[model samples]
Target chain A: MTFGETLAEAWGPLREDAIQTDAYLEMLLAGATAGAAPTGDLPTVEGTALIDPALVGAARALRDALVRIHPSFRFEERLAGRLRAAVDGVALPRAAGDPIPFRSRPTDAAPGPIPGDVVAVGRLSVLAPSLPEPLDRLPRPVLIGGAIASGVSLAGVALVAWRRRPGRH
Target chain B: MPVFGRMRRGAPADRIAVYDTDRAAVRAAGRDPRQFEALYRKYLPQVYSFAFYELGNHHDAEDVTERTFLSALAALPRFEERGDGPSTFRVWLFRIARNAISNHRRSLARRREAPAELADALPAPLDPEHLAAERESVARAWAAVARLPADRRRALILRFVEEMSTAEIARVMERSEGAVRVLVHRALRTVARELGARREGDARQRR
Candidate 1:
């Protein structure tokens, strides 16, 4: 083999495994941080290194380019809150305007055997009192009035549907 | 573990930052979930950054970060310490993040929307034309890096952005150290070549 090929054989493998090179650079950076004269280690890398020093420098600097852009501070805090809630088993609303689901499990939710009562869809069953706490605040009369209106509206729709059945005029 | 003892010339080893174990934090968090704030604050940036780079969007990154932490916090009680080191917890957390990102990607595929490109923001604030030029070059460098294949991009980020050693990166990426090294070497070369080409193109335009 030519002398150049011989040198290639010697250095080819070293360039691939940069473990030592990285160790040296790390130690060099550490030494500089310690306020040593800060001169020795860099030159050693530059002198003996076959790979371009600019390439190595560029690789090191890439970290700065890929710098950790943080989540907004608000996002961080909100996520922390959610994680805390998760730990406590408090079911918080995931999105804005979404009703905070009851923490009660499916087996625990007893939807009464009444028409229009939501059969528990897994953990999502909107059990009457468990969900509509706001309705519980209104005066008893308004709730009664609203329930009567809903029942009337439902019966009217049902009566019209039966009268418009296929066999009826 | 090789300990870098405090350099006693006038100590070449000026003491750096504080050190704490993931194990201790995990154990504390497991006992009282409230203590988890320590681990949450510690790893939020890392997990968020990983998802951001991998998914190339802030919203998805936040989603993944939130999922990873929520899931981790729930699973904390069941977390058995496999070893006496700090990184076992870190590795586990990253694995969780990796899974979350994959699940997200699957859903994203169903939606059929292209993942958004990463925003090119300068790392540090700077002013003046020279500083602007420097930042632009840095942005271009990362853009080149971002265009690399996923494995290569991940390896580069783990090695550089996360400042993980090859061994650590291998465990995180679930690859051999030799594979990780090859990924970095090829990624660097691709980046160098792309940057060189861009420079040549700019020079031609100038002339």
Candidate 2:
């Protein structure tokens, strides 16, 4: 393999700390020897000469160049200031008697009834049974008239129910 | 083994401890907005640097950074902590920054304005007298990075510039760890080849 390909292959492992120097040297040596023809069980001379320090140096130099060119902008103070203002805006103090902000919760969990709705329901429940007490205190003539009216109303309701009842036809 | 198990095994114990501490801080921030200062202080530089590098200008970077933090603060209440790891917060925050950058880029494209060069994005104080000395190499490197495929360039920047680990990068990039590694590998190879070719051309020019 060419020096560039060899460096590329070794660069990731070396940079990521996955391989130590010994492993790198072994890999380089293997790459160097891969193309040599075997001469009948003879011990091949270790070709350490093919391992040029210049290739590794060049790779490291390139990495350094790239890193040096990484633009450093000092926007921390400005950004933090902006974030502080934004956070303050979001976390503003609630006014007295203000309702708590609505937060999303699980769909299966039902939300509690509103306070105003609860108060209206309570007032209705309390007033429903006492509604007839005022009518009971009417004068005798008025009470008699009310009874006659109630009877007429009951008769009207019975006629309507009978008309609408099933099998009436 | 679970995916997190592999990550945990690969990560140093101290790193995991720091991650846990950061996660706790995030949870505290969720409960009390005042506590969010800790997170904002901690990740401000990282997020800012990422935005600056990605967008290649401080103005846009600051704008995006502000939007990212504001959006994060607004959404903090809904941030659920499953006791997974600190990567959750990093990933979530970076996703916000990435989207902001994308929107900024789209707007710029609509306006027909090109992003400034990476070197031009440096702050005034960083523009040393010797900047001209290293301009050629820096330009070549920046150009190579710009020419890379989008995902590959992002992966490379997150890996080298942000000094993020593969697992963290995968979380931010929303890719598998294997895919991130392949991207970095290919990106590095491309960059090396480009630099080598440039050097050869320079040599020929000198001759």
Candidate 3:
């Protein structure tokens, strides 16, 4: 493969813990929006001691670019009207938004993965434990003690009931 | 409600509610195409934004967005909501959008890329300094993102723009969650490098 192709496919670890990068991103985006004011400090993520501040800012910038772009009112309403009419001849109120201007094209237009093309029943998984981890946390001794105590109590109650029989009295 | 409401703590519940609401809307829309308005309004911004970012202009975005809903309305009768994850309705809708975008891309392959003017966004910021800085940053980021390969760019847009979880993105991208992570990681690294390099270059030119 060419160097560009090789570089395109290659990736590095997010941190030693190998926690998912998208999770960190979710945290970063949330943090960036909450703060609003530029802190100049990189957002800290779990399982990583250091993060490149530039990366954080770039992610934020990309998000900002996306957030600002909106469809024109005419187009939105026109489409809404068309869709509304298409549906069982139902006419709906017109839709509207601020008139938008020309914007830059995205570098790539391929949808990557078509959701309909996916027919696999299960997601990719391998070497996962066959059995799930136990959800019960009580220690064996405590369980046994509780069971024995309950059994003894039941026996005593049975004995008392036997002694209180009407024929014996 | 806006496509993505205020990100509150109950996001998971919000997600489930979104799924529940989508299925309900899908059911209603299935019966009556007019009922699809709830869904169209809910997802119009998301679908349009996806196309706008992907296609890079209002014209193509509108086309793809329109095709997506039209196809969705036509296919509503067959859309059976299965239990896979949240936003099955959206996943279904985006699936349609993804296909429409692909077809549109092929048709326009020979055509020039979508025309874009980055200076003015929908609502211009009041402060000139803020506006200029935002435009520069947005331009830098968008250009760097545009440089990415198709899959990587799509992954980044879905992750950052759509704010989808890794699993959800995986579902949308038809890849494993692990693979989607790598795509986003590599894409982010690449975009960061470009952003940093461009910033330094601009500074040097100014000097």
Determine the iRMS, in angstroms, of model 3: 9.2
| Tens digit of per-residue lDDT, candidate 2, span B140-188 | 7777777777787787667655656667777778777666766765666
Docking class of 2: incorrect
The number of residue pairs in model 1 that clash at the backbone is 1
DockQ, structure candidate 1: 0.18
Task: After superposing candidate 3 on the true structure, give the runs of residues whose Cα lies further than 4 Å from its correct spot.
Answer: A1-20, A32-43, A89-169, B1-19, B109-111, B118-125
TM-score of 3: 0.65
Candidate 3 lDDT tens digits, A1-169: 9988676555334432124456567776676567745445555667434446566666667766656356765566556545533542332222122111111223573543221111112321111222112212211111223445789999999999999988995
Q: Order the candidates by DockQ, highest first — what do you get?
A: 3, 1, 2
Tens-place lDDT digits, model 1, residues B113-132: 22235544344545666677
What is the number of backbone collisions in each predicted candidate, taken in the order shown?
Answer: 1, 0, 4
Which of the two, 2 or 3, has more TM-score? 3
Clashes of 2: 0
Return the lDDT, model 1, position A157: 99
Task: Record all residue pairs in model 2 with backbone atoms less than 3 Å apart, i.e. clashing.
Answer: none
Q: Write the per-residue lDDT of candidate 3 for residues B114-159, one digit (tens) a residue.
A: 3244333335668878687866677667778777888998998887
